[model samples]
Target chain A: DQQVKQNSPSLSVQEGRISILNCDYTNSMFDYFLWYKKYPAEGPTFLISISSIKDKNEDGRFTVFLNKSAKHLSLHIVPSQPGDSAVYFCAAKRRGIQGAQKLVFGQGTRLTINP
Target chain B: EPEVTQTPSHQVTQMGQEVILRCVPISNHLYFYWYRQILGQKVEFLVSFYNNEISEKSEIFDDQFSVERPDGSNFTLKIRSTKLEDSAMYFCASSGDAYNEQFFGPGTRLTVL
Candidate 1:
């Protein structure tokens, strides 16, 4: 079962504009959410994260908002730059059946920032 | 600046041959993990290791898959018999604590032909 889902397969935004990527999860047990940025032929790099306890978390140009009631979260990048063009993945960590740290990931959304 | 490192950026092996992927996680980090991503797919967790033992594994980690921490700094994943379906980019990650964020390696592209 896909516990995490990124409905939008791709997104485009003009440079200096705002870009928003959305993600949803089916598992209510997940409490920690994270966003990762990946470039071709490279491993994903952590961008930002938010805990269920907080509704939002901001890191410079990136902000993540979580809505527990809706089981949804979003990442917002302000003043999007061409460098921001990459695949973004949403991940959630939940206690596994064996009480282990298991991260469930979404399919990923390809973000393209036009110059 | 302590990041995870993986060897052999790319590997090509014949089907049914055994292959070993190596990783060296950051020093002082305890929790280690392995994840794989097929082209155009999301990253899937394969296994997590702690205290020199496997803490968790997904269904994808079947009989052909195994992990070992042969020494203090090296972690390895072994595929007893590689299949074409096993071709993917395998990533190694490490975190200092269970709830902490993980750092990932550049990834090793394993192509089973």
Candidate 2:
């Protein structure tokens, strides 16, 4: 099922530039959105997350913007560093009971930072 | 920081053979889950366990699959009969509460011949 989609299969950015990665979802029931970075042979590492009630959430150099009306979200990293080079995945989950809920993930986008 | 961990980094089994993947989630997390990712596909949810029972499961978690928490610190996923399509990376994750983000283990790559 293609509930969540990351259209960009790959992205390249130079050091000190802003890197923007976009994602879109077709499910309106999804109330939570998260961005994760994954390295080869490693599990996804959480970067940031935003609830549907909010439009934006920022953590240090990373910021996530959400637009409910368009069902779109984007992650922005300023002054991109080499360490940020990895595969990025966008995931969404529906609101449910007080327990672990299933997450729908998008096809990952490989981000490459060039020095 | 405490984190989730998985054993048997890689496993290879013949088709129809039984295999069990083990995991040790974060010490305080109450919710545990199993997810798998094929070589070129997005991660798919398998099942979620809580209070010694399965709280949720996806369509992919068919009759051949089972999950157990036999001990205090261990969670396991067992496949009674493996198939070629069962070759994938299995991940274990845990969340402290309903609102907290789930932490994932490194994953175990299972190859069914």
Candidate 3:
């Protein structure tokens, strides 16, 4: 079963506009959430992350907002640039006692920023 | 910034053959992990290793699959008997600590015939 889900498979936005990608999770145990951006043929690059204790985290032009009650989170890119076009994967982790926490990933949303 | 590096960007092997995928995680990172993605599918966790031993593994990582940190720099995943379903991209990742962001390699595409 997909514990983390990104229902929107694709999104298109104009350059210089805002782009919002949403994700939902079924596991309430997940306490840490992150967003990664991947380009064609390249490994995923970390973009932003938020801890359960916080509702929002901002890094440069990217911002992640989390709503624990809704089991949902979103990544917002302001004044989106063409370089922002990539597949965005939302990941979550439930802390474990012994080992590194395993990440549950969404199907990924392909964001296209039109020039 | 340090990044994870994986070898043999692509590999083709016969079913039932043994195959090993190699990765060198960032030098100082302590936690290591392996994840796989089947074509057109979401990425799935395989296993995690630390301090030279496996810390956790998924159901998909069965007896046929094993992970080891053979040395200070190299971490490896070995599939004792490959199957057609084994064709997928294997990624290596590392994190400095638990609950920290992970750095991923470009990925190794394994095609088992």
- i-RMS, every candidate? 2.2, 1.8, 1.5
Candidate 2 lDDT by residue in tens digits, A1-115:
9999999999999988999999999999899999989998888888999999999999999999999999999999997999999999999997564544877899999999999
> lDDT of each model, Cα atoms only?
0.93, 0.93, 0.92
DockQ values, each candidate: 0.64, 0.63, 0.73
Docking class of 2: medium
Clashes in model 2: which pairs?
none
Which candidate tops DockQ? 3
Q: Could you give candidate 1's per-residue lDDT for residues B25-102 as a string of tens digits?
A: 999999999999998788999999999899989999999999999999999999999999999999999988888578
| iRMS of candidate 1, Å | 2.2
Residue by residue across A10-73, what tens digits does model 1's lDDT show?
9999999999999999989898999999999888899999988999999999999999999999
Candidate with the larger TM-score of 1 and 3: 3
The runs of at least 3 residues in candidate 2 whose Cα sits more than 4 Å from the true structure, single-residue gaps closed, are: A96-100
**Two-way TM-score contest, 1 vs 2, winner:** 2
